[model samples]
Every structure is written in structure tokens, then in C-alpha cells.
Target: MKKMKALIVAAAALSLSALLLAGCGGAPANDKKAEDKAPAKEEKTTLVVGLDNAYPPYGFIGDDGNLTGFDIDLATEVAERNGWDLELEAIDWDAKDALLNQGTINCIWNGFTMEGREGKYAFSKPYMHNEQVVVVKADSGIDSLEGLAGKNVMTQVDSAALDVLEDEEGQKALADTFAGGAAQTIGDYNNAFMQLESGTVDAVACDLSIADYQMAAKPDMFVKLEPLSTENYAVGFAKDGDQAMVDAVNKTLKEMYDDGTIAELCEKWGEYGITIDNWVLVD
Candidate 1:
């Protein structure tokens, strides 16, 4: 009877050891199951950006039916890295503000200016600094801004440059300095350049990077006279506390700047990148 009791106790101890091992082993499986479902809760939303499809070097469509440009390409790469879908909406420049306000688009991811529109819209930290360069023919006698008097200068309709010319004091200054020459506003910046090309306008005032890109693409056709005013280019997000989108975009923009993506794009387009000190980066 004693021997039988000892064997029974030994079997019970073995069974208890098996039960303890089973519980410990099952704990790992439960932890792994919890991990498997964690990713499901981490899904994120894609971003949609609005831009003008005809703006070259910044954002535009290619002959291959692809939407490609400095901004478009950079934004797309950022979105892809973050597992976000990017919807590039081609909208009229005049409708840009309306679209953003109505949520028709999330943000204007283009070469938006921050100077004249100060405190007007919410802006991301400036991505690239630029200056407006004056364009003229190589043979034109116009070597500096001082010589623009009585000349027909061109700019884009509703552009900040036009504002610079129209502000009462600014307009008076322009008139007195340039012999009261008029600065006409065309439908697009390209039109202003074209007017210069066709000899219809004396000069074209445009972003230096853009003028460089245009001249490089069609060499021997343009001559950037001189830089007008330096400005910072940034993306426009919602004006309110839409900090989420701002954080995401500014994060990607900084990444691009650090990784030489922005510089590469400038070099690829053969335009000299502007220095940051000349313009401010609004966060």
C-alpha cells in the first residue's frame, strides 16, 4: 500500500508540472495574438493636395500623362513613405482659397507665397526660398530695374507682385521711379513670360527658379534680367488649429530638405536654389 501511494503522488506531481508548463507556454501565444491585432488599430489616412497642373517645375503634367514636378514628386514620395495615398487635384489658382476653405481640398501644396498673405492663411514651414527675377531679351538695353520707366511690364493676375505694384505708396513709388510705366496682369505667369517672348511686353517678372527652369528647357530664349523681391514658398494648410496636417507636412518637408531631395530637384531642373536667410520659414 505504501509503494502504490508513492507512485500515485509521483504521477500527480508530474501532472502538476505539465499544467504549469502549459500555462506558461499559452501566455506567449496570447501575447502574440495581441500583437497581431495591434497593427489593425494603427491604420492612417491618405493626404490630398491641390495644385495648378500648368505650373512648371513646381507642379505640372507631363506629356506621358503623368503628374510630375518638383512639388508633386516630392509630396508623392513623402506620402508613399508614410503609407498615405496622395490625390493631386488640378485646380484653378483663383479657386485655390475656396477649395481649401470648403474642404474640397486639404491644402494647397504648391509654390505659395507667405509675404503678402501674412496672417491671411495658415502656412507650413517654408520649404524653398525664391526671388522674383526680371526677364528680358539678351539684347535689351534694360540692365536694371531703374530702367523700366515707361515700359510695359507683365505679371500674373491677382499675384502678389501686382499687389506690390498697386499698394498706394508702392504704386506711387513705382510711377515716380519708372516714369509711370504700367505693370499689366495676365491670366497666368506663363502668359506674362510669353508676352515678353512675343515682344508685346518689355519685361516679365517671375520667380527666378521658374525663369531658370523655363530658360533651361528652351535654351537661348530667355534672359533673366535681375531679381525683384525674395520670398519664401510654403504649403498652405487650414488656418485653424489643423496642426495634425501641418505636423505631417512639415515633418516630410524637413526630411526632404535634410536628405538633399529639394536640392536634387533644383539641380535636376538646372535652377540655382535660393538661400534660406533671404526668406523666413514660418512654422
Candidate 2:
């Protein structure tokens, strides 16, 4: 009787141990199966685009007090097509290099000139052609670049027009004949126009597109002289930054051009000289 009781106890202990081990082993498999059935959370990419908000037809504050322009619209579309979250960062035009270097912004997209800055930034393919021109009041009688000589001319600081005026071999000879022997620099075009209106400056040197917008906004107020230099407009990325992003932008621009999205935008901003004729997408 003692042996039978002992054997029965041993059998019960072995069965309990087997059942516990089986339960422990099965729990992990069930947990793993449940884990496998769960959907993975997708990560999204955010593209931060830096631009001069005051630059009209490209990026600017409309009467609605919101950022809206050609580049803004183009960047928004690019972000949407790439499944990226878009962030438009308004930055000081002169401090663009620092912002790009610090990664505060991804790229400079507001009417950025790529002709003279090819070595400084990783530029996307040129999307449009631009010209640096001088603007004077209609009655100022500055019908040609020659008339700008010996005048108090002004241009935006760090702008392509200024660059042309500063280039010793370029339009610097013409700029040297100005009132101060050089073109005066300002922070923005609006201020330059204000100074021109107040007769503080004789003429304003700027991009033709900007001049066109200003002329249309205030008819019979300004006249654009001959072009100082012709250049191309492109997105400026940090030279050492993401080339992948530049390539992506280039691809998107090409796609936009093919699908007539760019043309539509040009039509919308036609008053600023942003037309399909200006678009020069090579490859």
C-alpha cells in the first residue's frame, strides 16, 4: 500500500511538471504569433524648405497673411507627391548660408540664382531664366542702363543684381559710375521701392520678375531698364548636404513640367513674368 501511494504521488508530480512546462513553452509561441499579427507603424519624412518670404511670385505673404507663391506651391506639391510632411521656413535672405549650414532649413527655394552659385550649393536643375535689371520711376527718364550712371542706385543686399554690380569684370564698371561709386544695399525690395518713391534713390536694381510684379501692382510707377545679367533660377541646397534631396527635387520639377502643373502655376502668377516661356528644364 505504501509503494502504491508513493508511485501515485510520483506520477502526479511528473504530470504537473509536464503540464507546467508545456504551458510555459506554449505561452511564448502564442505571444509571438500575436506580435506577428500586429501592423507596423510607418515613419514619415519631413522636408523643411527655407525661402525668402518677401520674394513675391516665388514665396511671399499674401493679403490673407499666409505664405503663398510659386515656389511655395511647387514645394507643397513636391512634398505631397513624395509622402513627406512639408515645413516652409521663412528665413532672412542674407543669412541663408548660415541657415543651410546649420540645418535650420533644407534648401533655399525662393528665386535663388544658380548661375553664380554653382560651386557654393548643390543646385537642382534650372527651372526658369531670370534677369537682373534696373527700375526707375516712369518720369525718371532712365530708359537704358547708361542712364543709371551717376545715380543713387539701390539693390537688395546679397542679391544677384548686387552680385552683378560687384563683379569687377561684369557690371561693376557701370555701378562704379553711380552716386557713391557703387550700388547702395538694402534689406528688401519694398524698402528699396519706398526709397525710390521718396526720391532717396534714383533707381532700383533687381530681378526682372520682381520689377514686373511691382510695375503691375502700381501702374505707371516704375520702368525696367535693360537687363544687367541673365541667370537661371534653381533650388539651392547645402553643397555638403543631401544630394539625394536635390535629385529628388530635380525629378519632381521634371514631373511637374511634364504634367502641366508648372504651366498652371506660371499662368496663375503670369503678372510676375513667371510664364512657361521662362521655364528651361534640361533633362
Candidate 3:
């Protein structure tokens, strides 16, 4: 009888130990609940920036073969500040509109001109000033816009120069007088310069800063005429693009400018002669 009692007591002890083990397991359940209530990290949005990667000091492949430029740095900072990913896409400059319309890129963040392009896209505030200019061979004797009259003139396709050439108030008449039907448009500036080199074209109209860059590199090869028309540079989004994004970028850009980020970048690209230190956004 005593043995039987001992066995019962042993069984009772084992049952108690089992209950304790179950309670310990329940503590882990509470831990799991706590984990479930923790906040989840938000996913980042990628701001796919489209640009003509050949344009230097704005967006271009650097000596190290990585894409680097003034605009690139700003875009990266804006993306980081807004918790968005930065994506650089080198696109055909002429197809910038199509790319934006198709949502292939979020915005054109290169050296995009905003004067003639008003109402074409949702535009960010102008960040800098630019000018259209003519480039000719050193001995071409084209010292002014009038010198381009009746000459074979070419420019990059879809460039601000071409837009100016087409605008009635701009240089439309001058371009019409060129030997060709209109200003010959090439896919890139390199080819335009090549045409000028080969004497196939008498002159090339392009952005003043780009003309300066090319002239600086080949000092004895080319000469720039005085600016044809001055214009503002801004970021371009599709007409129906995300307004929220436009507002966000503009806010961030203002912050950067106030904090001197834009000034520092301008100084960094000072050799390119592009700066926005005194710029005031029209709206």
C-alpha cells in the first residue's frame, strides 16, 4: 500500500513538472505576440531619373566609367532624403517625351531647358540659367548669329538650340536661311562637332556650356558666338505625372539650396561654367 502511495506521489510530481514546462512554452507565445505587434519597415520608392548620359557636368559617365554629374548628385540626395531609390537611365535625348509619357522614367533631370517646353511637362522650379550658342570652326569666320545665315548649320536633335531655331521669336528665320532645308539635327553633340570638323557642316548650334566644354578641350579647333538666347534649366516630368512627387522634389531641392548643397555642387562644377547661386525660381 505504501509503495502504491509512493508511485502516485511520483506521478503527481511528474504531472507538475509537465505543467511547468507548458507554462514556459506559453512565455514564448507572448514573445511571439510582441514581435507580431512591432512596426514593419516601409518599402522605398525608386525615383527613376532619365537623362542623356552623354551630357557632362549634368549627367554623364565619368572617367571611372560610373555615371556622375551635378544633377546626379542632387537627385541622389533628394532620393535619400525622401526614402526613395535613385535610378539613372541613359536615354535617347529625342525620345525624352515618349519615355516620360510611357512612364519609363519618372523625370528628365539633366540639363533640360524649360522656356519653350512650358505646359509640355510638369516642370520643377528652374535651378539654373543656360544659353543657346553657335559653334564654328576656328577659321569659319562665323563671329555672330548673322554669320550662320546661308551656312550649313546643325544641332543635336531635340535640343534647346533646335527649339530656339524653330521658334518664330527666336532664330527661326536664321535657321531657314541655312543651306539645308532646316537645321540638320544629329543624335548627339559629338557627331555635330564631327560634322563641323569634316567641313560637312559650316556651324553647330548648341548649349553655351557644352560649346565652352568642347572649345576648352580643343581650344584651337572651335570658337563660340555670343549667346543666341538665354533660358532657364529645370526638371521635366510628364504632363500628368505624379504631382506629389513634383512637390516633394521641389521641397527637397529648396531645402538643399537653403543648406548650401546646390552652391557646393555648383562650385564643384565651376569649370563647366554652370552655377545657380543667384537663381530665383519664377514660381
Candidate 4:
């Protein structure tokens, strides 16, 4: 009877030990299995670009009613190459500074000018050359800047052309000779051209590339005077915004230039005077 009790007790102890060992060992195995079944997810980034939707050859609404243009295509390519999703925000040209500073948009990528704005924003390296000019009716008999005297000349509000014309050391003296002693401001190029077509405005000061597009689209309707001022196009970020992003864009632009991608884009927008020969990426 004693031996039987001892044997039974030993058997129970062995069974309990086995269960304890199984519980401890099975828990770790199950945990490892669960860990092996799950994977860490990769996060994707979204790149938001700001532009003037009415600005053509850079960014504009197409015949299909979708946003399309050189800057749009270029931004799309940059986003794709960087494995990012792209979002284009059409903004009021005059409100760009506020939007950029307020974080409403990431960066201004449309035919954004770099000169006279260097101190206000962190800009990518100049990618393309640009010129500011005045467009008039082909037969308006206004061949020179001096001819703009006492005429109602106009420019897009908050534009580089406006900057040039308003500069005291630049064209301000010439603008002072106009009817208002300054250029009238409009909301957009489309409106500026509309006013020109209706003969409400004597001339429209604008970028050369945009002028070229307008001229090509409506041949003989308008002609541009000699360039008022020359400048360069660049991507603009808020002065306090991401410098890394600017560096990334600069690097990508150079890569594009080297790999013939920029040349192709230039060819696509060649009608607007965007040619690889004008691309400023060297070495």
C-alpha cells in the first residue's frame, strides 16, 4: 500500500512537471509563429505641389478638363521617381506667399521665378531661363517700351513681371510713364489676355513662355515687345520650410537633365520656347 501511494504521487508529480514544461515551451513557440506571420509595413509619402492652374505650358487645365502642363508633368515625374503620391493644388497667384507660409501647399513649382525672391524663399537651382515681355495687338504700333507711355498697360498681380515693372531701379521709371503711372493688375493671364482681346487693355506684361503660347494659339492677334527683364525659373519653398526637399528636387532635376528626361520634356513644351538648350544644369 505504501509503495502504491508513493508510485501514484511520483506519477502525478511527473505529469504536472510535463504540463508546466509544455506551457512554458508552447507559449514562446506560439509567440514566435505570430511574429513570423506578420510583416512591417512600408509607409508611402505624398508630395503636394502648388501651381497656377491657369498658367499654361507650366500648369493648366487641358481640353479634357484635367490639369496638365510642363510643370505638372515634371512634378508628376518627380513624385513618381521618389516613390511618392502627387497632389497638385491650384492656388491664387497673388496668395501664393500666404499659402506657402501657412503650409497650405508644399512648394510652388509652376513657372516660378527665382530672382528678387531669393531672400524670401528657399529656391531650387535655376532650371530654365525666362524673360518678361509686354504683349500688344500686332498692329498696335507700340514697338518699344517708350511707346507704352500714357497707355493702359497691365500685368498679372504678384507676378515677376510686376516685380520687374515695380522695381525703382528697374522699369519703374518706364512704368511711371503709363496712364496710371503704373501697370494695372489682373487676376490671371487668361483674364489679362481676355482684356487685351477686348481692347480694354493696351498691353499685357507677362512671361515670355506664356506670351509665346498665347501668340501660337492665336497667331497674329498679339505680338510681344522686346524683353523687359530676363530671369530664371525655379521651384520655391518657404524660407523656413524643407531644405531637404529642395535638395532632393535639385538632385532630381540634375538627374533628369543628365538622363535625357528633361530634354524630352523640353521637346514636349518646345512650342513654348522650352528647349534643352536653355536648361541650365551643368555638371
Q: Give the TM-score of candidate 3.
A: 0.83
Q: Candidates sorted by lDDT, descending order?
A: 4, 2, 3, 1
lDDT of each: 0.72, 0.90, 0.86, 0.90
The digit string of per-residue lDDT tens for model 4 on 164-265 reads 999997899999999989999988899999999999999999998899899988988999999999999999999989887888888887888889899899
> What is the lDDT, from 0 to 100, of the residue 226 in candidate 3?
84
The sequence of per-residue lDDT tens digits that candidate 3 reaches over residues 1-283 is 9999999999999999989998888778988999999999888788999998887768888989999988899899999999898899999887888889999998999988999789899999887778899999999877887877789999988899998999899988888888875899888887788889999999998987788778877889999888879988888999998999999988998988888888788788877666665355524
Model 1 scores a TM of: 0.75
Q: Candidate 3: where are CA atoms >4 Å away? A: 1-40, 276-278, 281-283
In model 4, the runs with Cα more than 4 Å from the true position are 1-42
- Count the clashes in each prediction: 1, 0, 0, 0
Output the better candidate (1/3) by lDDT.
3
* Candidate 1 structure quality by residue, lDDT tens digits, 1-283: 9999999999999999989998887878988898988865665666779887767777777889888887787688878867788899998888888888888888887777677785767888877777767777767788877778888788776665666666674444663454345577676776677777888888776776667766776677777765667777888876873777778778876777677666666566544233333333333
Candidate 1 regions exceeding 4 Å error are: 1-44, 168-172, 175-181, 271-283
Worst 10-residue lDDT window, candidate 4: 274-283
In terms of lDDT, model 1 sits at 0.72
Please report how far candidate 3 places residue 165 from its true position, in Å.
0.9
